[model samples]
Target chain A: MNHVTDLPLWVAWLVAAFLFIGAGLTLTGSFGLYRLSSFYDRIHAPTLGTSWGTAAIVLASIIYFSALQSRPVFHEILIGIFVTITTPVTFMLLGRAALYRDRSENNPEVPAMDLPKDILDKLKLADKTESVYLESGERE
Target chain B: MSATILLWAITFAQIMLAIAMVLALARMIKGPRAQDRVLGLDTLYVNSMLLILVFGIRTGNTLYFEVSLIIGILGFVATVALAKFLMRGEVIE
Candidate 1:
């Protein structure tokens, strides 16, 4: 009673293969999410799943459906595009939030913050010292 | 013959996705901090979206694809709002 029943054996096998590969990549990415230690590290892990992982699965879906229906189907592209654009934005915001929290807490893991006043004062003193040396050199 | 094989493969994939979902849920429940929990939630959303997609493949229906899309959008918005809240204590400020 199924439509795919009428499709050729090779076509069905190809669709299955694509689905498996996509699902495997997604599983690997999520597994990395569990295995990774820090938030930043974990952030990179999901990208694997979001980027190519979603692509493969969506491609598989498109191929399978189009072949089965004997027509082009592309609605899955919407999900693919949505995931691609949103993943980076979410990761960046999360990374920035983590950085802000760490800096506020004065966590030793991050580099020291550059203070504006300290740099400006150092620059002024350096300029004065340079001018004094230049005047002395001119006299000599 | 091929239909049977395809069914078996799809079932296998479904099982794998279910396990992945469980792992994400474990992370969500076992978080040591708020941000960890948020990260876990985000991961869970992605896993669930994929799960729905796999279901669509198995059932040979396009309807589940729409659901997956909705889930993706909602997950993105939810994670973004949570991340913003993490930066400042308020979602809107």
Candidate 2:
């Protein structure tokens, strides 16, 4: 509580700068999620927050705590590491799931799997319709 | 002056994060597809976690970090499960 006043001027400024940067990036990512037109396009937006936004804020926290407590306090790194490891796994799984769902439904907009002809034949997926991407000459 | 600046910055960051959470919620509610909803939910989770961390900093307490960490873990698991369910139409298959 009162630690805010106890913090040195330089530390306070540094923390404030990081707070603005992290919060701004997170807000930008969320806006992209709300505004993007397609699921595929939207998938890339959250990473801005998940990666650097979280990092900058966590860095600020580390600096704040270490400055106040007079010790190296980095337990926040646990959140950082856990998030870094898990976000890609979740997003990749979600992306693959979305792709599979779209492909199985024969959605014309999604690209066909780019596999070798022999592999496609062996998998019995060779008869799938060609993707209508550039053929339509207009992006969705 | 420094204390006032830090205090105001923390307040502003919290407000911004809360707004981000609301925007994510809007996407979740307005999604045109299941995957979009799931993605929005994921973004919501991240925003809330960041908000919690900021709260911890404001109060000078490390306990909120653990809570935020737990939230991240649970959110990741929930998202993965939902994605699995979407992919195969089943969660445990």
Candidate 3:
């Protein structure tokens, strides 16, 4: 509150801009979280916030504080790094968990683990082709 | 001129983040299933962390940075454990 004015002309504007963008992205992600139709679709929503949203705000903080205090304030980068790394892990695990739950419950809407006939046929064809290539090489 | 703009911007940002948190809360409470609830909780955690960071910026305190970082760590651990629980009936096995 007291120190915000101490920031120079350009720094103030930069910080303000970054903060606004970050907040907007986060809000939009939450809206997606609320509006999306399915759990799987909803899983993709928060990534907007965790990715650029976190990065923008942290960048603003770094710029504002580093300039204000006359030294680089870099610890915020640690948070950015941590968020970027962990978000994927959590989301992946959550998605897999939901899929496992759905499969266990025998939910018909979910496609069976067994591939469709077309894909299975393609794989079988490929297997046969590989065996034929091996036999041809042996004959040569 | 810029000071007032900056103040207004900070206030605006805070309001937006608060709205995001509320939306996340709504999803968490209105969940059709456990996974949705867990996802909502995760989003809520991230929104709150952002809110705290904004608060830190408003007050010009570095301490909020540390607080936000800790919140991030806790949220990740919590989400992972909850997700694991969802996958298996038990956690840690």
Highest DockQ among the candidates is held by which one?
Answer: 2
Deviation of model 2 at A31, angstroms: 0.3
By TM-score, highest first, what's the ranking?
2, 3, 1
Clashing pairs in 1: none
Q: What is the TM-score of chain B in candidate 3?
A: 0.97
Global lDDT for candidate 1?
0.82
Candidate 1 predicts chain B with a TM-score of 0.96
Candidate 3 displacement at residue A31 in angstroms: 0.3
Q: Write model 2 residue lDDT over B21-79, tens digit each, in one string.
A: 99999999998899999999999999999999999999999999989998999899999
**Candidates 1 onward: DockQ, in order:** 0.54, 0.84, 0.70
| Residue pairs in collision within model 2 | none
Q: Candidate 3 local accuracy as lDDT?
A: 0.92
What lDDT tens digits, residue by residue, belong to model 1 across residues A1-140?
A: 26568777886788778778777877888788788887667777767778887887888788878887889999899999999999999989988888889889998887767669988787687688988767776999
Taking every candidate in turn, the Cα RMSD to the unseen true structure, in Å, is: 6.6, 7.9, 6.2
User: Candidate 3 chain A, which ten residues in sequence have the lowest lDDT sum?
Assistant: A1-10
TM-score of A-chain in each prediction? Answer: 0.77, 0.83, 0.80
User: All candidates' lDDT scores?
Assistant: 0.82, 0.91, 0.92
What TM-score between 0 and 1 does chain B of candidate 2 receive? Answer: 0.97
User: In candidate 3, what are the lDDT values of residues A82-103, reduced to their tens digit?
Assistant: 9999999999999999999999
